[model samples]
Target: MDRDARLRKAVLWLKKKDPKLKRIIERVGPCTLTMMGRPYPVLLRAVISQQLSNKAAATMMDRVKEYYGNGKNFPDAKTLAGLSVVKLRKAGLSVAKSETLRRIANAYLDGSISDRKLSKLQDQEVLDLLCGIKGIGPWTAEMVLMFSLDRWDHFSLNDLILRKGIQRNYGIDENSKKEILEFTAGFSPYRTIVCWYLWRDHAAGI
Candidate 1:
């Protein structure tokens, strides 16, 4: 099925599977989960976003792009790979993040990672490949799968906000991984859409 049809089906399935999540769906309105952009740039921004507020991450990303390329366009892998870690730090990236960006850029530039290849891989394969990079952990890999590759099955248990959202909405303790998994098991294959609603609900303090 096409993306919209699949999302619609996913939403209906979710509404049937979980009443609480159905409430979230109703409160949050439509599932607007979407592929954000190309793998490289999306992954690049994900790396920049770690441990930072959304506003801070966006500001830093814009600064990095402006410093390395045109203010409006994200830099290519060659441009990123060519940048020194120190230069990237000057653009407001932390040292570790700068190093990570360089490693990611090098991974793309050297053909170790490719958007086209990633598009064809199974979810686990994609996660394994991406998480193999030194600084790319499971959470980041999961975000890339959901946002960049348009995969809908991923739900990052590592996301603290998501954990909080679950706790707030479902009254489950955030630290209970097993419980969380069991509670959300029915959301599989459409977990990304469920996640989008949870995020929206959390953002709206619902």
Candidate 2:
């Protein structure tokens, strides 16, 4: 099956298999489930989304899109490398975000990494490899893995909503790695999707 279809199946299975998940699933409904474009652009978008509100990210992404290569479409590593950081910063990206995008582009063009390799890697492996690059960190790397690579087996423990959701829903005492992993284990292969719902739920105050 294709990735989107598989994701649909995964989300459905999560809701059906676990009644607790069903509550959020019913209210939040299905997610976008669409991840388009090549690896670098998607990763850039992931980086752009980091530590920023959705509105701010959307505005910055629009500015990036205004560039010849929309970060979503033609985020060619070579092209991005040649682009001006000052221009990108004027486009509304923070200094760190511009640097991160450059690092991602360099990693891709320098034969240090590729989408195929990222796809094959375990989540932890992907995290370590990407995080080794300047400006790439665990949370941003997880976003790249979860959204771009569409690795079903991902859990963004760094996400605050997921941690709070677990505490609220499952009554987990702490959001440690062990507790979070154990609580979210049942959502396997779709924990990121569950995280999305929890974030949405938290936003809606439901």
Candidate 3:
């Protein structure tokens, strides 16, 4: 299918999956499903952005951008591999995260990873490959799959806001992890967008 067709399908899927989400469309602006491109480093930057406020991530990314002199060309595996751990730590990355970056860079440099290979991988597979780096986990992997890959259907039931929203909506005081997982199954293929509205509603107190 063409881009327009795919986008139309995504819109229709999102609309049909949840009426609350349709209300979100009528109120707050469109969901910012911007693609920050496909590089691991780019997605890693986004992972760093997650949980923390956007302003904080921008500051850290600025440091990295300054180090590289330009954002147009992504610093490849070789470039990242050459960075000293101390320097990256000084740039506002946790020691573990810096190390994860190094491991991923090394994997890329050694030809164990390639863009071609990533295209064929599923979310769980990509998560498995990436989480080998230590700092990267399920949440971080989900963010990469959703944003950088432009995955139209993805969500993190493990995410606190979404979990809270689900519990609140269902009027449950608490639920086992298994119950939560079972509940979110209905949002499959659109769970990502469902989570978006969940967060938005929480923010708006609506």
Each prediction's total of clashing residue pairs, residues at least 3 apart in sequence or on different chains, is 0, 1, 1
Computed on alpha carbons, the lDDT of every model, listed in order, comes to 0.88, 0.79, 0.70
Reference-based TM-score of each model: 0.96, 0.84, 0.82
**lDDT, residue 88, model 1:** 92
Number of the top candidate by lDDT? 1
Worst 10 residues of 3 by lDDT: 24-33
Question: For residues 76-192, what per-residue lDDT tens digits would candidate 1 score against the true structure?
Answer: 889988999889989899889999999998999899899999999999999999999999998899888989999887778889889889898889999998898787776887877
TM-score of 3: 0.82
For model 2, residues 75-156, the per-residue Cα lDDT tens digits are 4788777777897898788888888888888888888889888888887888999889888878878877777877666778
Q: How do all the candidates rank in terms of TM-score, highest first?
A: 1, 2, 3
Model 3, runs deviating above 4 Å: 29-32, 69-74, 172-175, 202-206
Candidate 3: clashing pairs of residues: 154-192
Which consecutive 10 residues in model 2 have the weakest lDDT in total? 66-75
Candidate 1 accuracy as TM-score: 0.96
lDDT of 2 at 5: 82
Superposing all C-alpha atoms, what RMSD in Å does each candidate have to the true structure?
1.2, 2.6, 2.8
What's model 2's TM-score? Answer: 0.84
